[model samples]
Target: MNASEGLWSHLTGGALFWLTLTLVVYTIVDRLSLLARRNPLANPVLHSVWVIGTILVVSGTPYETYFDGAYFIHFLLGPATVALALPLYENRRVVLRSLVPIVAALAVGSAATIGSVIVCAAIFDLPAMITISSLPKSATSGVAMGISQSVGGDASLTAIIVVATGIAGAVMATPLLNFLRITDRRARGFALGLAAHGVGTARAFQVHPLTGTFAGVGMSLNGLLTAVLVPLAASLIGG
Candidate 1:
């Protein structure tokens, strides 16, 4: 009993603490999202980020120290990303058949995402750096950060905007989709992944496996497409 207690203390009081806390909190948030029918406003990733970030700030924990533990989960992000290939490969037939729509959605979605942000920022007379950073708000966080840095924008602001965009997309897309009568799982999933990124994909998974798989493909493909296109567009627009 004493040894067990000591071991628990060693871990929870050490580098595993933050990691454990994050997983536990996220698990709870995920369950809540599930109960709430995977609504975007209650997105697990968004909630987890906000909740965890607040705890870190209020507790005055240095991000670096917390990262020591958090890095384990962070490292798994790459492997999890790679794992999306499983669903994509399994659904290759569906993907091949829908190639035209997929391509069209990516092109239009990416352009609209970038265009709308830039235009809104311009109308509001936001700073060039802010407008540039906001350009990738629809992309996944990792890709958005890269785009922000490449275009001389604020990476931190980009992260915040990306999260907000994802939460909003995840929340709003479902109703819009239902209204549009787009019941095709592939289309639904693809749209979610394209517009909302990871959070949308997560929501898609909760709805159905077929949706999840296509969402994974959309998320991965869109990331690659945006990473390449945004920089060129930025340069042309003088961002």
Candidate 2:
């Protein structure tokens, strides 16, 4: 092979190329988002997913091949999840005061989120496995995969559902909140994170620190609740 052609093939085939390309593309979109007055519609995660997905489709890169290169970024999800506690701790007063309500809301929200999906899927005559898998779509993607496994659901499908759920919530958050007159940043953040998980948390950070902090709490709490409740509910139903 010619030197330039060989080098191009080598770079594209390497993990560094895919990983760096992902980050650089995401960064550019994030900056564009900011330039657009931080428009909610111009979300970085939404755009990044679109751009990367398009690239993969165009390049004929198998999902597995892309994931192999991107696994390092995926590995950091655990650390990022644990780091969510810091913000929750920073707002410990709010957490402490609303502990009862937080727990109560989580229970109801988790149940409703899972149950609603199941019901909708049933009405549409979706396969049982798909319905079960989608139950954890509101949780963080990693946790959703685990829950999907436990519930005999498809992990890959759950991952896609989780991202779709996040993008839907992130895009609708501003308009919905304004319409509902939900002016409290903390409340908005919490609702978004509860509904959207990490993607929503990122969007919250773009809005304000306080918003992001509460979003962190909601994201973590909702994930914890769904992780525990979903499998148990599946068992109860399956039994």
Candidate 3:
């Protein structure tokens, strides 16, 4: 028992410390990126992930061992997601008024996003697993990976694709909205969230308080719906 405790402390003491140390690196790099007029679409999370991921690979540490200690930080994600509801509740009146439009947008946007990705994959002759993994690219990583895994796709690939799609969406959502003359803040927020997931929600928050609230709603709702839809869609396509 004592030996096991010592081993745990030894492994986690330095590598597990990476999570905390990464935050400082993230903050400094984020500020520098912003000062250099870097695009917010190039989020600090993305950069920090690359840096930390490389470090993990080089150190030859196993993920399960590291995760044992880092899982506490991940636990906060649920609460953070729940807190988004507060902003939505504060904007309840506007949300109620726009419920129909929001639902309509979600359906159309969801279908378009899914259909186009599947079609593009078909045209490119991408592998079946790759196509399946890409289907949920617009949803949150946790939900998207589950959706992919349920359909026999690669969860790691799903995460990568989801992150890439989100970064692309976050970087382009505003410009795309402008080009399409999507001037309504609610619409922009909803579109951003539906298409970009967390990164888009973050971008929406920068636009306005109300926009951020709507984006959070859209992100959560789309995640729920996509979790249901992507599997069904994949089955149908395979059939």
- The clash count for each model shown is 1, 0, 0
Instruction: Output the lDDT of residue 123, model 2.
Output: 88
Evaluate all candidate structures by whole-model CA lDDT and list the values in order.
0.83, 0.86, 0.82
Please write out the lDDT profile of model 1 over residues 1-239, one tens digit for every residue: 69988775566456678998999999999999879876667878778988988988886777877778988886775677788888888889989999998999888887887788778987999988888888887778877888889888899789788888878878888899999999999899998998888878877887889998888878888888888877877887793
Give the C-alpha miss distance for residue 221 in model 3, angstroms. Answer: 1.4
How many angstroms is residue 85 displaced in model 2 relative to the true structure, after the best TM-score fit?
1.5
Give model 2's TM-score versus the native structure.
0.93
Instruction: Report the C-alpha lDDT of model 3 over 5-44, residue by residue, as the tens digit.
Output: 7885576556457566566778886887677565665576
Residue 42 lDDT, candidate 2, scale 0-100: 93
Q: In TM-score terms, which candidate is top?
A: 2
Superposed Cα deviation of residue 67, candidate 1 (Å): 3.0
User: TM-score of each candidate?
Assistant: 0.86, 0.93, 0.85
Error of 1 at 140 (Å): 2.0
Backbone clash tally (model 1): 1
